[model samples]
Target: MTQTAAQAGRPRTRRAPRRLPYLVRQLGTLVVTLFAITVVIFGLTAIAGDPARDILGQYATDAQVTAFQQIHGLDKPVVVRYLDWLGGLFRGDLGISYQSNGPVWDVISPRLGPSVVLVLFSWLLTVVVAVPIGLYSGVRLRGRRDASLTFLTLIVAAFPEFVLGLILAIVLGIWLAWLPVDSTAVSAGGLFDSPTAYVLPGITIALGTVPYIIRLMRANAREVASETYVRAAVLRGVTEPSLSLRHILPNAAPPVVTALGLQFAGLIGGVVVAETLFGFPGMGQLLAQSAASRDAPVVEALALMIGALFVIANLAADAIVVYVTPKLRDAVR
Candidate 1:
C-alpha cells in the first residue's frame, strides 16, 4: 500500500501551471491592436474620397464613375461597406483591387517571398555585425575606438534608407560595377537569378536597422557590465571573454532582444523606401502603387498584414524575454 501504489491509482496527476493570465492579456492586446490597425487603414482610405473617382480621372463622365461605384459596391453606405469588407476577410477574401481588378492577396502573394528573404537576410546580418561590435564597444566604454564607432553609428543611422541605398548604389553598383544597380531579380527571372542584384537591397535594409540594434546592445552591455555579479567576476580575475560571453551577455540580452523586436516595425518602413529605391517588388513597392492609386482594399490588406506582423514581433519578444529571464518567468507564472 505504499505511496507508489496510491499515486498509480489516481486518474490524473498535477501538471505545471501555465502563465494563463499573461497569455490571455497578450492575446487581448493583439486583438485590440489588430482592430485598431484595420480601423485606421480603412478610415484613412475612406477619408481620401472615392477610389473609383481617382481611377476614372477628372474628365470621366459622371455616369461612368457612378457605374464604376455601383459595380464595385462602392455606392453602398460607408459603414455597410466596411462591415462587408470585414466579413469578407473571415472568408479569406482580401477584397478586389480597385486598380488591378484582382484580389489584393493575389497581388501581394507573389512579392511576399522575396520580401521575406530580403528582410530575414538583413536581420541576421544586422545581429551578426552588431553584436560583436557592440560587445567590444560596450566593454571599451570611454575609449577612442568606441566613441568613434558610436559616432559613426549615429551618422549612418541619421541617413534615410533611400539615401543610403543611393550611396551604396553609386559606390558599389556604379563605380565598382560589382553588383546590379537595382534588384530586378524577379523581373529578370527568380530571386536567385542574380545573387549580385539581391545584395544591394539586402544591404540597403540592413543599414537602417543595424545602427539601432548596435546602440541598444552597447547600452545594455554597458549596464550589465556594471552589475554586482559582473564586478565581482572582474575582481576575481575572470577573463574578459569569459566574463562577457558567460555572465554579462546572458544578463544583458533580454533588453537587446526587446529592442531588436521593436526594430521589425521600423524595418517595414525601411523596406518601403529601400524596395522602391532598389526596384525590389516587395510589399513596399505594392504599397506605393496601392497608395498612389488610392486602392483602398489593397492598401488595407497590406497595412493589416504589416500591423499583424508588428504585433506578432512584439509577442515573440515578450515570450523570449519571459523565457530567458528567470525573474520574469517566476513573476509571470
Candidate 2:
C-alpha cells in the first residue's frame, strides 16, 4: 500500500513547471539580450568618426556641416540620440540612410531576400553533405577512411573562406564554366531566374562550414555511441544501421542542432564576404558599401539586426534542444 501511494505521488512532486512561465522567461531574456546589443551598436558609432563630416565632405563649409548635423540630430548628445533612435525603432522607423537618403528599411528590404536564399542554400547543402559522412566517420573511427576524411577536413579548414571562394570561382566558374562567375545576374534577375548564380557562392559557403560541422558531428556521434544505452543495444544484437540511426543519431543530434543554429547566425559574417566577392545584391553587399561610405544609420541598423538574429538563433536553438530532449524539456519547465 505504501509503495503504491509513493508511486502515485511521484508525478505530482515532479510535475513540470507551467509552460507559460517558461516561455515568458525566455522572452524576457531575449528582450534583455536585444537591448544589450543595441547599446553596443550605438557604442560603435562613437568611434565611427563624425557622420556629418563624412556625409557633407571635407570641402563643405562649417555652416553646411552644422546644418547637416542639426538636420540629422547628429549635433545632439549621444544619450539623447540613442533614446531618439530607440524610440524610432519602436515606431518601426530605421531612420534615413546617409548613403541613399532613403528609409533604411527600403534599402535593406530588397536585399534581404538574396541573403536569406544564400543562407538557406548554404546551410542546407552543408547539412546534406556533412551529416552522413560525419556519422560514418565516427562509426569507423581509427580506420584509414577516418584519417583521410579528417585530413581533408583539416586541409579545407586551413584555407580562409575567401580563399575557398576564389578557388571555387576559378575552377567551377572559369575552368568548368558550370556556374556563373559572379552573382550579379541574380541581382539583375530574380534568384529563381538565375538559380545558377547561387551555385558557386552556396558551394563556397558550404565548403567553408562543412569541415567544422563534420568534425563536431563525428565527435558527438562517437561520444553517443559509447553511452551505456548504446552498449546495451549492441549487446542485445541490434543491427549496425538501426543502432546508428535510431539510438546514436537521436542522442547525438541535440548538440549538432544547437551548433547548426549558431552556424546560421555565423553565416551572416561569411555572407558579407561571399556577397561582396560575388557581387550578390544582398544585405552583405549593402553593409560593405554603407560602411565604406560612413552611412552610420544603415550601418547601425545592420549591426543591430545581425545582433538580434544572433540572440534569436540562440533562443531558437535552446527551444529546439529542449523540445527534443525530454530531460531538458522537464528541467527547463
Candidate 3:
C-alpha cells in the first residue's frame, strides 16, 4: 500500500515540475516581449519631437513646456517612465492622449473594431478564393491553366495596395458606382450598408494578400501532390476532391497557417495607409493622427497594442502548428 501511494505521489510530483517549466517559459517570453516593446516605444516617442510642445503649441513659453513635461513625468528617467507605462498597461490604464485630452482606450478602442472588420472580411475573402485556385494550379502543374493563373497572380501581387485602392475607387466607386468613393464611416445600415465605401477597401486588402496565399498554397500543394502518399492514393483511384482536401491540404496546412497568421498581424498595421487614403476610422488611422500630433501616450499605447497583437498572433500560429503537426508536439515533449 505504501509503495502504491508513493507511486501515485510520484506522478503528481513529476506533473508539477513539468508545469513549472512551461510557466517559466511563458513568463520569460512575456517579459522579453514587453521589454522590447518598451524600448521601441521610448525610441519612437523621443524621435517624434517634443510631446509637450505638440500639446501646448509653439507659442507656449519654455517654462510652460518644462512644467508640462514635469507634470506628465516626462522629466523622470527613461527607465522610470517605461516602468510606469508597463505598470499602467498591466492595470488596463493606457494613459491619456495629450492632443485629445481623452483616455487612450476611449479614442483607440472604437476605431479598432472598424479595422478588425475590414481585415477579417478581407482575410476570409482571400482564403476562400486563394485556396481552391492554388490547389487547382498546383494539381495542374506546368499546364497552360497553371501558367495563366500564375501570371495573373504575379500581376495582381505586383500592384501596390494604394494603386489598387485608387483603381478600385475609380472603377468601382466612380464609373460603376457600386460603392461610395470617399466615405469611411460605418453606417447604421450595418456591414452591408455602404458597399461603395467598404467594398473597395476590402477588395484592396484582399488583393494584397491573395498572391501570397496563392503562391504559398500552390507551392505546398505541389510538393504534397508529388509525395509518395499522394501518388499511391492517385494510383488507387482515390477521388480527386477527397484526396486533395483530405490528404493534401491537411499536410500542406502548417506553412499556410503560418503565412495567414503573419498576414493577419501585418494587416493590423498595414491598414493605416489604406484606411487613411480611404478616410476610414480605424486603429491605423488613429495611430497616424497620434503620430502626427505627437500624442505620446496614445502613440505608445498603440505601438504596444500592435506589438502585443503580433506576439499573440505568432504564439497562436505556433500552437496551431504544434496541434496540427504531431511531430512538432512530440518534439516539444
Candidate 4:
C-alpha cells in the first residue's frame, strides 16, 4: 500500500528490471564472436602462401606479379585490407571473387536458394516429427517403447551425414535408379525444377537431426513429467498423455528450443557435406570450391555469413523462450 501510494504521489522511482531473457548477453557474445571470426579469417592470409602465385601462377614474371598485386590491392597491409573488406561488407558488397571475377555476393547469391530450401525443409521436418515422437518416448521412459526408440535413434545417429547421403545416393541413384545421382535437380532453375531432388537431401539431413532432438526432448519431458505439477495432475485423474501435453510439454520447451537453435545453426555446416555428396550448387558448394581455389574474399564472406546466421538462430531461440514462459518474462522485466 505504501509503495503504491508513493508511486501515485510521484513517478515510481524503481523501474522493473529491464529484461529480455538472455538477449543482452547473447548479443554481447555475438559481437565478440563475429569480431573474432573476422580476425581469424583475416589471419588466414598469412598462411595462404602468396595471392600472386595463387592468382597468376608461378609462371608469371615478377613484374606481372607485382602489377597483379597492386591492381588487386593485395600489396596492402593485412589490417588495411581487412578494414577495406569489412567496410565493403557493411555496404552489401562482399568484394570481388578472385575466381569468378564478379562481385562475391552476386556469385554466391543464386546458390543461397538451395541451402535455404534444404535446411528449412530439414529443420521443419525434424521438429514436426521429433517433438511428437520424443514426447511419446518420454512418456514411456524406461519402457519397451522408449528402448526401441533409443536404439533406433542410436542407429540413425551412428552414421555420419556424408555416409548416409552416400548410401542413399548409391541406393536411390544407382541400384534402384529412382532419383538423380547428382544434384542437377536443384541447379539453375531452383528447387521446383526437380522437387524430387530435395527429397533425398532433406531425408538425409532429417536423419542426422532426429536423433539429437529426440534425445533432448525425451530427457526434458521426463524431467518435466517428474515435476510436482505433473504429479498433481496425475493424482487428479488426468491421464499421463493429457498431463504430458498440458503440464509437462510446455515446461520442457526451453531446452528443446535451445537445442533446436543449435541444431539449425549446425545444419549450415552439415549442408556442406550434403552438398558435396549430392553435388548441389549451394552456398556450401560455393564455399568449398572457393576455399579450394584460394579465393580468400569469397571464403571470408561465406564464413562470416554463416557466423551471422548462427547468431540470428540463437537470438531467435532466446526470443521464443522469452515469449513462452510467463514467469521468466516477468522476472526478466
Clashes of each: 0, 0, 2, 0
Candidate 4 ranges with C-alpha deviation above 4 Å:
1-26, 140-145, 222-254, 326-333
Deviation of model 4 at 213, angstroms: 1.2
lDDT of 2 at 247: 94
Cand. 1 Cα-lDDT: 0.83
Candidate 3 residue lDDT tens string, 1-333 = 999988988855344445444335655787798789878887778666567876798899999999988877888877788788879988999987787778889888877767778888888878898888888777766877778888998999899888988998899888988777775646344554665566667778888889989999999999999999999999999998899889899888678877887777666666776887788777777888888877889888888887887777666666666666778767655
TM-score per candidate: 0.85, 0.84, 0.82, 0.81
Quote the lDDT for 324 in model 4: 76
Model 3 spans > 4 angstroms off? 1-27, 187-196, 226-251
Model 1, residue pairs in steric clash: none
Quote the positional error of residue 242 for candidate 4 in Å.
6.1
Model 2 lDDT per residue over 1-333, tens place: 999998988865576545666678889999998998889888888667687877778899999998888878888888999999999999999998877788999989888888889989999998998888889888766778788899999999899888999999999888989888778887787767898888887887788779999999999999988899999999999999999999988888778877887787677668888888898888888888888888889988988887787778778877777777788778766
Each model's lDDT: 0.83, 0.85, 0.79, 0.81
| Full-model lDDT, candidate 2 | 0.85
Residue 204 lDDT (model 1):
87
TM-score of 2: 0.84
Q: Report the Cα lDDT for residue 234, model 2.
A: 94
Pairs clashing within candidate 2: none
Off by over 4 Å in 2: 1-20, 140-142, 220-251
Query: Per-residue lDDT for 106 in model 4?
Result: 86
The per-residue C-alpha lDDT of model 3 at residue 158 equals 93
